[model samples]
Target: MDFRPVLHILMRIVLITAVSLLMCVPVALIYHEPVSPFLYTSLIATILAACAYGGRGKQELTTFKRREAYLSVTLSWLIVSLIGALPYLFSGAIPGITDAFFESVSGFTTTGSSILTDIESLPKSVLFWRSMTHWVGGLGIIVLVVIIMPSLNIGSYNLFTLESSFQEKIHPKIRSVGRRLLYIYLSLTFIETFFLLLGGMNLFESLCHSFGTVATGGFSPKNTSIGDYSPYIQYVITIFMLLAGTNFVVHYYAVKGQFRKIKQNEELRFYYKVTFVAGIAITAILFFQTDRSLETAFRESFFQVASIITCTGFATADYLLWPSVGWVIIFFLMFFGGSTGSTAGGIKMARHLVALKNVKHHFRILNAPNAIIPLRINSKPVSAQDNNGILTFILWYFMLFLGGSLLMAWLGSDVPTSLSSVATAMGGIGPGLGSVGPASNFAHLSDSSKYVLCGMMLLGRLEIYTMVMLFNPWFWKN
Candidate 1:
């Protein structure tokens, strides 16, 4: 694999992260917090970017191939997470290396799991930079899906990428698609910020929340997450989280006034079906079992459902304290993720839909001795390669969940904490069950456990195979 293009892009990514760091400077100045943390981190990122560029490949980035693409994506997230930790370290917000990396990985993966027990105690600038990690990571996920992953063929995502309509709606060039998605992403953030402002949130909190909402990242600047906010604010966030969880392609079609295409999206349909069913079920649970009003029950249920389904991880209420059935509903939804081609993580609805179709096909085959059946999604027949890829991905997802849970338990966490923490980490959803639930942070977990969860976050956010490929011996072989 040619290292030049990958080197070149990594340099640019580091520079982009450096600029993101500098973005916190203004916030620091405005809030009268020390700016050294961001400035110093930005300086370090600049030097690393320079070093990466120093080894520039003469070939253009477009020349990078499959192996390089895999290396590039894996290294991009890992390196950014590595550099992202500098802020926490410099600011002394999180002082330990393991904890800092854990927080950084959580941020860059947009996992929203945090070790910070008192979020309100951090400086506004550090919090802004923290939220910026989500915005950047979210952008990274969007770019990878729209412009890169389609070509990589991971998880048989070609189902979405192979569609000709997508090419017509968005430009074919990588840079063009990235720019277009950036506009859509920024628009969502700004629009949500405006709405939150209208709901009486301050500009700082609004931007932070907007960053989290649009990214589907749940790292709020508040200790209570979204629980302290008004219903109007929660409702707006719930709606946007739903939007964020849907495939960005659907949003692109909606932007192009192509509502017909959006409506025809099978994965979007599946996503909505899961979300509403889960939401209504939780709403009923909350309403009958508690003293909350119908509207409050509806708001909290939908918000929590959207949060978990989308992997947004925000909380308007702690469902762990609710009826057992309420939290149980959430537990299952962790495995049923949002649409693919979106920043939201988990196994993804695209794979789940395919898995379902494949299962139904098998039942039919069981009734017929010899039958040729094709698995289909979005009215297009799925290739056998894609079928195997999707199912294998699902199987591996569960296997890793089991392995990580056991590892966590072995590391001394109780069964509930171990299972849900691993599940939530792998799902990129914050607030797991047990000790890591919405009301608690991961601070209590051992350093070994935090590191394990960090690894889970990367594998989950990258859709597993991308990162796991690096561990395979042949990937490094000539």
Candidate 2:
């Protein structure tokens, strides 16, 4: 391991985080929240960054190799989450060190799981930091650092790929692609905030919810989430969640007047089609079986379906109390996440599409002994390497999910609670069924179980392989 490159990256992350906190401090003060500790935390971060980076060693920064890229991505997230926890700890809102770390991880991972029973009682500044973590985390910490500091442009592309979900390379130049992504991200957040404010939400609430929506983090300002808000506000959030879960590369293409490319993207078409069909099915079930009006049922069904399908986890109503089939529908949807290159996490839709195509091809080859078939997506034949990687990733993902569920069950959780918690945590979806359902928080879990779920969340957020590679002995070999 090259200590200099690792130290250099860590210093840069600390400096970036400190600056981010300083920018947020004024916002906290305006809301009458205490800023003294936040100020001190920022100072500490800056000083630490300086100490780490200001060495007189005659070492040039090494170009990050693939292994270095994996290490840097993992270390950056772990270190930044530790630093990000400072505000929560210093602010006294989440005094326990474990809880603070958990909140920070949840925020930065865009997992949206909260241990706090009362989210509304937290101060505005702390809340801002909470939502800010989601925003920063949504695009990815390493990607954000790469865009802001162009000096690291060359080595950072590998780190970006390691941090990002989609295996698809969108652009030849990483910097240009990063800039376009940031632009699209900012525009979506701004538009969503405006719509929320127009729909009767206050400025602060609108901004916070907008951060959550665009990030697809689902950290609602209100304790009841979107349920306490106007129908218009709920619908606005629903629309943005759908948008947020889409591939940003497609959005970039759309912005650049490539309408045909946008329309022909197979993943986007499949994503919307699944969402529409699921929405109709769930809405019909809720309307016919429950005591809700057709409009009310459709609204609730659409919101919940979108939330779970995108892995956003925002709740306007408790779908756990719905019929048995409704619960099963949600459970299945948890596995099919948003598109690749989007903020939402899980096994991405593109990977599933590839896997399904390969499955069909396998059967066809079984029947025709002399036939040669190629798996294709978006009219291009899938490479053998890409197909192998996707298949391996999916297999390992399920194995880990099953292992996590069994561990949780052994730690005193029921079967459904264990299953959903495992799925939700591994999928980066916040709420689960039974006790860890949409309406309930994860406060009731045993401390060990919470830690387990936290690990699962990190694994899910980092796209499994990134975290799993750290455990491989070959990763550390010199």
Candidate 3:
């Protein structure tokens, strides 16, 4: 089974997780909050780091197979999430291990759903750490390790493919690709922070929201999410959220002055089309269904649409309280997240594009039973295997969604809450329609339910296969 290589890579991932958790210590120190939580956590992490360090030199990791790569990535996420819960546990912000793990899972999965009811009451350091989880998780912790440390260069592409399900390949070298994506990610974050500062937010608030925005994460420092911010601030966040939802490869193209490539991207075009159509439809609903002014209607509708479609989960309005039609529109948008290669979570636009193209192909096949039909995307023919894989993924996504929803219902939520909660959690979009709506939080749910959502969040973030493949008995035998 090549267990040594798997353990070796797993330990390195653990060390990276430890180091990133330690990064939060400075924030704790700066705020004069109880540093004991971070200090204790860091101490434990350092011990693990030392163990990982010692174990590495015993066996050289020259290459890793797909089996080892999958196991390492899955175990790494689970281990990091477990360790991330330490601060909340030690500081007593969220005392229960289940709740703490749930929150940490939500953060690292970039699922904005929160178990903390009083968000603003927590220490600033805790809040910063919470937001930092989102940013680290946005691109993935493994990808970061591969880029910064050249020592683990062997089989890095396998790890990269295991972590990132996105389609576009930015660079031939995995490390160069990682660097380019990281650069775009960092630049977008800084720009959002700058624009937010101009919108009158303090440095801390601006930085936190920027982290949330560029990562397509929704952990706002304010309890009201983005609703508490000004119109200008909301508009700026909306723009950045759109940018965050875009495929990083498109951003790479823009950086290199290749406008034609960016313009011709089918997924990019589909993303904008869906966003604009849904945004306009919801805006009209708000315009006529309520007394909100035109400006208010457009801003709030566009912001929420962008938030959900990108799976960002930042809410400028209580979408549940909107008209029935409005809520329905927002709910459907939850399934169609941003483009492939984007940080946003959902059935990516690329998959949807594939599904739609396949549907068209099928209809044409009915017209000519003997004719050969090739599924094409962006003017290129797609392999039947790729098309079938897309369909299979989408099928798995819905099956998980239904199963989770029923589980949530059996765990004591009503139909609306259960359905929306599972949908939101599985979509990695925060705030569903009923009890866990934008105005509400997930704190009221049973511990078991929270744990269920946490698992679903991780499943969605890893996009089903990486985590699900672990459960197959044959996966281990190989």
Candidate 4:
């Protein structure tokens, strides 16, 4: 690994982050809040960026290898997150480093997990900055996965391909894809913001929620989450959440009016089917088992279904109060994340589809050993390598989940809280079951537990392999 190239690139990210911190100053002024928090933080970050600059020359980037790529990607997220914590610290909102770092990691990772119990009481600038983290992190992952990871084929193997027979024929150049994804990203944010405004949400709340929605990051300004909003407002956020969670290539094709390509997206179909079924099932239970009206049942069920499936953590109702079967469905759905290339996090729809196909293929083979049961997605037979990659990803996903749960339990969280907190953290889904449920925040958890969740967030955001491989001694030995 060329340490110079990695550090050089990281310094650039820090510089960019420093400049972004200044975006908060206006909000501070608008509300008569202290501007020193953001200014001081920006200056601190700028100085740190200067110190991090290796000045070993830009040509080293040409020699950047897979190891350097891995390190660069991991460190990029880490250092920005560390710097992102400065606003909270400077403002004295979250006084402790561990809690501030945890919130920052949650924000940058788009996990939406919060340690802030009184979200609305915070300075408007801080809340605005928090939501901005979601928006920034969302675009960051989209660019990283859609552009950079395809070059590191393994990192993106389970995601959409480079103009595959099944994939939309979007250009694969870094600039081309990056610019186009940015267009779609900004379009979603702005359009959602407009609609939230139409629904009578004030500008500040609208922008913040729109940021959360479009990013699939569920950091709402209100302490009640979306529960405080009207049905129209909640529906607006829900619709955009689904759109944001859809594969961005689908958005590109649809923008070009290529409806045919979208029709052929198996993962898209699977995503819709899963959402529909889960929503209907939960709606039925809420209607039958509770006293809520039919429309309320429908609204609560679908909003939650979209939220959990997309890894957006917005809440209109607490499902932990629902029947066992209802909340249990929500719990299991944590593993079935949204599309791979999109910002939504978890095991993803592609892996779940592949896992199901494997099961059906095996059952058919047992019925007739000689019958050729070729597994396929999007009408093309999946390669053995890709098949194994997705399966291995799911396997390791659960393995890490189990190991993390055990560690959380050891860190003194009870069984249900430990399991669900780790599950939500890894999936980039905010709320979990037990003490960490939708109504609860992560503030009560020990600092050790918060750090553990932070590790899970990074691991999940990088799709487990890129960051996890850095721990391998052979990676360095080679």
Candidate 5:
């Protein structure tokens, strides 16, 4: 396989990351903090990217083979995270490479997990940069490459497909789809920020939380997270988080006055059903079991459920403090994440929906030996390839969850901590139960455990196969 195209794409991604890093400089300057971190990293990234390109462009490679796509996409994220760690290291925000890499991976993966114990103590610029990682990493580094850097247009389609969620393209032109995705993303950020500011948040807090919410990323500027904010602010965040967790393709259709398509989407319908049911169940439990007022219980219940299911990881309460039933409900939601083609990360509701339907069809076929039954989704018959792919993905996901939990337990974590942390890390959902719950952080874990969790985060974000396929001899041979 040709390596130049991959290197060229990597350099462009690094350059974009460098530009994003520079955005934090103004925040640093405004807060009267050290700007050297941003300045130095940006300079180095720019130089490296410039040298990689050597001021030349190759217009011939717009589309590439599947193997090249996998390699480029994986390297893009790994390289971006490597560079993303530079600022944290330079600023002394995270004192070691492992911790910095962990935080950087969590940030880029939109996993709200953090190693920082005292989040409120970080400099304003550093905190802003952290949230910015969520925003940049939210829409995806590959999507940004396809949109902003025209020189890499040769293999842009491959990169776009590798990065996008599992949904049909919204536009005929891949570039148009990328552009629309960016527009919807930006519009949502602005709207959320505006409402948050109106709800008594200052500009910085508003922008930071807005970035976190719209990306379905759970990073917050305050130590208490959304709990520290007003009910109004929390409500606004909850609504936006729900929106972010829905498929962006659905949002694209809604923007063009195509409500019918949105309504007909099977994964979306299942997503809403799951969210409402989970929210209501938790709300009833909180209201009946706890002394929280009706409205308070309902709001907090809905907020936490949305946070977990969307894989956003934001917390409005210490859910561990809730009764046993609440814990069970939360853990159950861990397996069913937001819809596919959404910012939220988990197993994805689409795969679950399809797998369940396929199982039902299997029973029907067994009952009627010669029946010509077919699995269908949203009135369309599912392909055998898709059916097999979803089934395999689900199997691998559970196997990993089991293995990861066992590994965490062996590392000395408590049973609850081990199980939930494994679930959270693999699902890209921040905050697990027991020790790593919402009120806690991951700082106490050993370096070895942190490294393992980092690997899990990458696997979760890439949906397991892209990274796992790298280890297969046939994958490389192809």
Candidate 6:
């Protein structure tokens, strides 16, 4: 391992954490909450950062290679999670280290899964930090760091590409692209928060929900999530959630006043179509099976469907308590995540699109053996490498999904709960079916199972390849 690259990234991350903690201190003080521990933690982080980077001047820092990029990305997350856990731990709200780390990881991963049973009871400052973690993490730490650190500009692209989702590349200039993405992200959050406030939520609630929605993290201040809000609030969130799950590049085009690009983008079109069809199917099921009014049923049905499908995992109602068919619909939607390059996680819509096209192409080739067939997406011929990468990613993802489920089952969860929990965690979707459903938290799971799910969340968030490659002996041999 090249310790220099690792140390360099670690120092950068620590510096970021220290700054974050320092920023949070005044908020804590404003709320009249204890701030000593937060300040102490910041000092510790600052000292550690200084020690790591002080000896070697900035001139000694070199460009990171691909392998180093992977290591840096993975290590940065781990370090951030570990350090991020300090506020929770020092605040004495969550005593257990593992639970604190879990919450921290959930926040940074934007998975929005929380072990905390009572969210509103926490201090406002702590809640702000929690929500802020989602906001910062939504775009990504590396991307954030890359934008600020001018010296690392040469190789920042490789790190950004490796860290982001399959379809999230903004432009050739890393800093410029990062800044544009950040602006778009912040604008969306501000707009959503404003709308939520107008829809009757308070500023705090609106801010928290905005953080969750924009990040697609789903860490609501209220335990009932969007279910506690009015129809207007839910509707506002639904639109934003849909936006959050889309490729930001599409949003960029829209922002640049390119209305035709938005209309012409095949992924965006398919995304809305899928949400519409799924919403209709789910709403119909809820109406027929449950006693809810059409308006209510449609609202709840579409909200939960959009939430889960986008991997946002926010809930208007506990779908687990719904009829069997409703449960099954949600189960299937767990695999159909939002568009690539979005904050949402899961097997992305683009991959599913490519996979479906590949299936049709195979059938065509079988029928006419002599025909030249190439898989196409958006009227463009798909490259063999991209196709293989998608296929391999899906295969590995499912294999791990099944394997994780069985392993969790062995650790004492039932088959259904275990399988769904693994799928949800691995997909970076917060809720699952059976016992581990939206109404329940992961606090009941065995320590082993929690650790397993944590690994799964990391694997899912990193898009499988970067994490998997680190395990390959070849990654270390050179």
* Best by the lDDT measure: 1
| Top TM-score prediction, candidate number | 1
Model 3 worst lDDT run, 10 consecutive residues: 154-163
For model 3, how big is the CA root-mean-square deviation?
Answer: 3.9
The pairs that clash in candidate 2 are: none
lDDT of 1 at 47: 94
Tens digit of lDDT per residue, candidate 6, span 1-478? Answer: 5567667877977887788777777777878998876788788888889887864344223456666767777877777788888889998878888898888888888787788888889988888888877876787833633332223332122221222332234334655776788899989999998998888898878988898888888888787887778899999999899989887767777788977656656767778888999888888888898888999988998898789877887888998888888889889889888877688888878777777888899999999999998887656566676677678878888999988888998999998889888888877779897777899888887778888888888888777766787999987897
**Which residues of candidate 3, in runs, are more than 4 Å off?**
57-62, 141-172
Residue 337 of candidate 5: its Cα lDDT?
Answer: 78
Across residues 273-392, which tens digit of lDDT does each residue of candidate 4 receive? 999999999999999999999999999999999999999999999999999999999999999989878899999898898899999989999999998888988787887887888888
Q: Candidate 4: deviation at residue 304, Å?
A: 0.6
Q: Which segments of model 4 are wrong by more than 4 Å?
A: 51-56, 60-63, 156-162, 165-172
TM-score computed on alpha carbons, candidate 4: 0.96
- What CA RMSD would candidate 5 show? 3.8
Q: What is the lDDT of residue 151 in candidate 3?
A: 30
Clashes of each: 0, 0, 0, 0, 3, 0
Q: Write the per-residue lDDT of candidate 2 for residues 1-478, one digit (tens) a residue.
A: 6666666777877787888788777888798778876798899999889887875133433355546556667787888788899998898999988888888888888888888899999998888888888888887732633332233232222222222332234334565667778899999999998888788888888888888888888888789988988888888888999999987767777798978777668888888988999999999999999999999999999999889888888999998789889989999999998887688888878777877888898999899969878877777676676677778888988999999999999999999999999898878788998898988988888888888987898888777766787889976784
Write down the TM-score of every candidate.
Answer: 0.97, 0.92, 0.92, 0.96, 0.93, 0.91
TM-score of model number 5? 0.93
For 1-478, candidate 3 gives per-residue lDDT tens digits of 6666666766766666667767777777778877778778867867876776665555544465667666776776787788889999999899999999988888888888998888999999889888887887886832523332223222221222222333234234665777777888899999999999998999888988988888788998898888877999999999999998887767877898978777767888889999999888888998998999999999999999999998889887898789999999988998998876678889888888888888888899999999988887666677766666678889999999999999999999999999999888888888898888999999999988998999999888777887898899987886
lDDT of 5 by residue, 1-478 (tens): 7666666777777887898888998999899999999899889888878876873347223554556656777887788788889888999988899999989888888888998999989999999989988898887832633332223222222122222332234223666767788899999999999999899999999989988887777999999999988899889999999998887767877898878777678888888889999889888999999999999999999999999999899998999999999988999888887866667888888888887898799899999989898888777676676677778888999999999888988998889988888889888788998899999999999888888888888888877876887789998886
lDDT of each: 0.89, 0.80, 0.80, 0.88, 0.81, 0.78
Q: Per-residue lDDT of 406-473 in model 1, one digit per residue for the tens?
A: 99999999999999999999999988999999999999999999999999999999989898988899
Which should have the higher lDDT, number 1 or number 4?
A: 1
Judged by whole-model lDDT over C-alpha atoms, candidate 3 comes out at: 0.80
Look at candidate 3 and tell me the lDDT of residue 471. Answer: 94
